[model samples]
Target: MPLPDPWNRDSLVWRIPLAGGAAESDDNPGVDPPEAWVRALAAVALDLRCLRYGREVNVGRLVWDLAVDSEYFVSIGWQGARGVGGFSRGEGLTVDASFGEAAVWVADTVQSELAGYDFVQWPSRGRHLLLPRLLATNPAWVDPHGGRR
Candidate 1:
């Protein structure tokens, strides 16, 4: 069965059964990441002022959906295309550093990475303001080598 849409408040009330007949408990919180990991990621989001977008940005929610073992790298305007769906795995500027190191990297890089792209005068608001830059430089949206797609 499909998991309920996580973004839907009504859907969230439905309790989806755990795989392998596992039970949820404080000692075994199922798929949730450790509190330390969550705090680290939350610190990153806070550093970015992502809370400014409220529910429109998933990073603000401090959800643990990324693969813990994967190497992280920067992704400029990573979530610019998701619209109201907000950030998810593979979104945002990633860092290969440890959580502590990642937090510092984010703090140091966010201002520089997001510089001049604030779209202060753009009519549309929220994270969409970053979309224009994303479209121009994102290889998925443009040919970085200056070749026709």
Candidate 2:
């Protein structure tokens, strides 16, 4: 299994691993990455549909369902696409915070998870002050990324 510490981006840019894949090996016990990817793709389709048209985006099991060994833990009764879900396997980091605080910390955590994120730029780039950024800038309709923004 991949080591867990690599996912934490406390300081610099982060990278979500788009690793190649696992071949059909006798040693492999679980679902292959390709299959997992396909399943994830399908899941995204459902989420998008529900997110747009459904009455609610009620996620019952964040860690077990949406977040796969998601590795993020924060205190919240409700979570949309935003905010931390549950703990990832490696270094279990527990944070008790409001939405804004979690937003700040989670940005670092997920920015670490993204494919190419500059964490070093954080100290200077106002990432440390992201909680307000999340609350202030979050549009009811548009998401953070420019696609929605």
Candidate 3:
């Protein structure tokens, strides 16, 4: 049998931009989000056991990037001690957490956010192991010519 689609209708992935709006756009340019919001997001990343990475620019600004495995990542541009941030997934989902309202909303929905991340990343984590089993069980997945169908 064919493997089931990894993404389903019930998946809680956030495809739309969050409250603050699209992270990057011609109208918005690239405005740094509030420092509080970036800090909050970093805290959430830690809570979720994600890895945090950052760099300092020559101008004294800081840029932070956080990721969950190789699946999802968010980059925040910081100016001095105050900045705002945005999150994006490899699948092209983006959320702008620049405004106060957006920041508050993100904090309030932490549980759901975690669930969403887990749901999306679950299949990816198992794909390597699962694919071999699937191919072994279902020969139709293989081509007689020695390549995948």
Candidate 4:
């Protein structure tokens, strides 16, 4: 199956401008989403409070380039203290051992919470906004009132 367009016009994903007078979207070729992992790392990434330049990096446009391009498993990583962010594509579907602490933290956090979810099926519109609501209803990830540590 063709991967879902990460650049869906209606979705929140947008282009980030580079130093030149061009946009990152200019060369980006949207990938066909993997059937096994229906979730957009982008959606979960948006809720993360990680800050950049006194603001949050646009998580909606953060695509797992390695995963989408090579058909491999991918992950997001960051180090708040060091101001570092990274993406990694696993050998197959597993995470690599060389990943840094921040990468591992983000990966572990998201995976643990999404233990049984396949994000590919999430609604195309407002998927980011709805994920918190969905997680709230899941007994494994959230309490009845929808708060968790």
Candidate 2 structure, TM-score to reference: 0.22
Model 4, 1-149: lDDT tens digits are: 54433333422222321111211233445633332232333324443432212222333333343222232334332222222243332223322322232233334444443332333221122222122223332212222233442
List the lowest-lDDT window of 10 residues for candidate 4.
Answer: 14-23
Collision pairs in model 2: 12-119, 12-120, 13-117, 13-118, 13-119, 16-114, 16-115, 71-88, 72-86
TM for every model, in the order presented, reads 0.30, 0.22, 0.24, 0.28
* Candidate 2: Cα lDDT at 124: 22
Question: What's each prediction's clash count?
Answer: 0, 9, 5, 8
lDDT of 3 by residue, 44-140 (tens): 3333332211221121122333221222223222223223232332222133333343333333344332333323221122232111112332211
Please report, in order, the local distance difference test score of every candidate based on alpha carbons: 0.31, 0.29, 0.29, 0.31
| Residue 108, model 1: Cα distance from true site in angstroms | 3.9
Which whole-number lDDT from 0 to 100 does residue 107 have in model 1? 35
| Candidate 2, 81-132: lDDT as tens digits | 3333333322333332333433344434432332123222221212222111
Ranking by TM-score: 1, 4, 3, 2
Candidate with maximal TM-score: 1
lDDT winner between 2 and 4, please give it: 4
Q: Model 4, stretches more than 4 Å misplaced?
A: 1-31, 35-38, 50-82, 87-91, 94-149
Q: How well is each residue in 59-98 modelled by candidate 1, as lDDT tens digits?
A: 3322223233223222212223223222322233333434
